[model samples]
Target: MLNWDDISREYQSEIENFQMLNTPDERNVRAFLQNCALELHERQTAVTRLYFDQEDKLVGFFSLHNDLVKVSPSLILEHRWNLITEGLTHFPAIKLHYLGVDARYRKQGVGKYLMEEVRSIAKEISNYSGCNFITVEALHSSLTFYRDRGFKLKDSTAEFHNMLFSLETLDNPTLEATPLISKQKIQEIRDKVMSVIEQSNLTYAQVAATSGLDEIVIEQMEFGTDVDVETLASVCQSLGIRFL
Candidate 1:
């Protein structure tokens, strides 16, 4: 029941007052808002949402963008790809790029509210666009924060862990249903697509020509903008890859 605000100059003063220090990730959130968030928004690299209290002070915030996840074949169960797309090796997904709650807002359900807001946005996008999973690269110290919200770990190294939440599970029963694509399968397909693109060493100009997308759009996609599913599919097709 908290109000949320899109980042803007009107809220600049309040945003400047936001602070955090628990982890490097937390500190980065503050730095991003103070220095880089507005530029990222203007460049279409990410969208940021901020939550504020009744006093009009910033309480928590998060950022989201498009991303790809590579899943190892060994992680997938049987027949999952068939549900998504036939002969597809990778798929597109939404990324929760950054999430942070001010220390003063922790334990007051602010974090949960921010996550629910993210889910709502993802669900809406899936209804019109094509998003199979909501993915995140969570800091090792914050793994439990995501896990409690139904995110599953796909991979882990020392610094961060790749996690995902299937959009299918978030579907509302009252709404029209869509075919469910398992997270593991989507990850597998993403991995394959990226692998193919890397192996081909396709340049941005070549990809723009092949995909029939504007060079600027293609460049933005490379920089993690949340592009429409159609554009992504076109890019994949041009790359001789299938995406679902």
Candidate 2:
């Protein structure tokens, strides 16, 4: 359940840590983040959040903001039309300020899921008349995901491989997907792992001793914290998977 309210509430811990840096921590920072999340959601300004669901788990978090294009006077004559065509109601680009998934859920597709949500919301906001480019401070790992989804590089930006996906480009605008791994299902995955060990004739003591994974890690994933990629790889490897 990657809903807004749950996302906001989890930021309290993050805000606390941020406030603690070089100063005594207080509740004010958490309050600010909670308030900002609301503002962003309402204005469609950006969705800043600490990704989490119920049962008090930690997921990744991020912030998005608006950055409408600004044209230089010399370039405006030629570039203005180009900008306008791209949805320059103010300017086409919307900035991606911060984005990251929780360490545990780093590879579970939560980041992509969140990006899809952002893309959908941006498209709805665009209304086809204005707004085209989704400007993000694209991290190296994230570039492939965006590119694979049809976002292209805008020439001027470097490590920030600029990309855009036109709403008109999508074949199925009505697409929707439920979470593939729900709490119940993730629990089942783990249980299956345990069951695998059990069926292999390994004693419970041996299985537990070998797993090394703590209860908190398992519970965190089972409760909606996206499992980390490395952990999943290890888990699958242990289970004799060949997902390549």
Specify the highest-lDDT model's number: 1
After the best TM-score superposition of candidate 2, give how far the Cα of residue 33 lies from its true spot, in angstroms. Answer: 9.7
Task: Output the number of the TM-score-best candidate.
Answer: 1
lDDT of 2: 0.50
Worst lDDT window (10 residues) for model 2? 19-28
The lDDT for every candidate, in the order shown, is 0.70, 0.50
- In model 1, the runs with Cα more than 4 Å from the true position are 78-82, 172-244
Question: Which 10-residue window of candidate 1 scores lowest in summed lDDT?
Answer: 171-180
- In the range 154-239, model 1's lDDT, one tens digit per residue, is 87765677887767766432323223555565456555655676688977677766664445555555545434434555667888
User: Model 2: residues >4 Å from true position, as ranges?
Assistant: 6-10, 14-47, 69-91, 156-159, 171-244
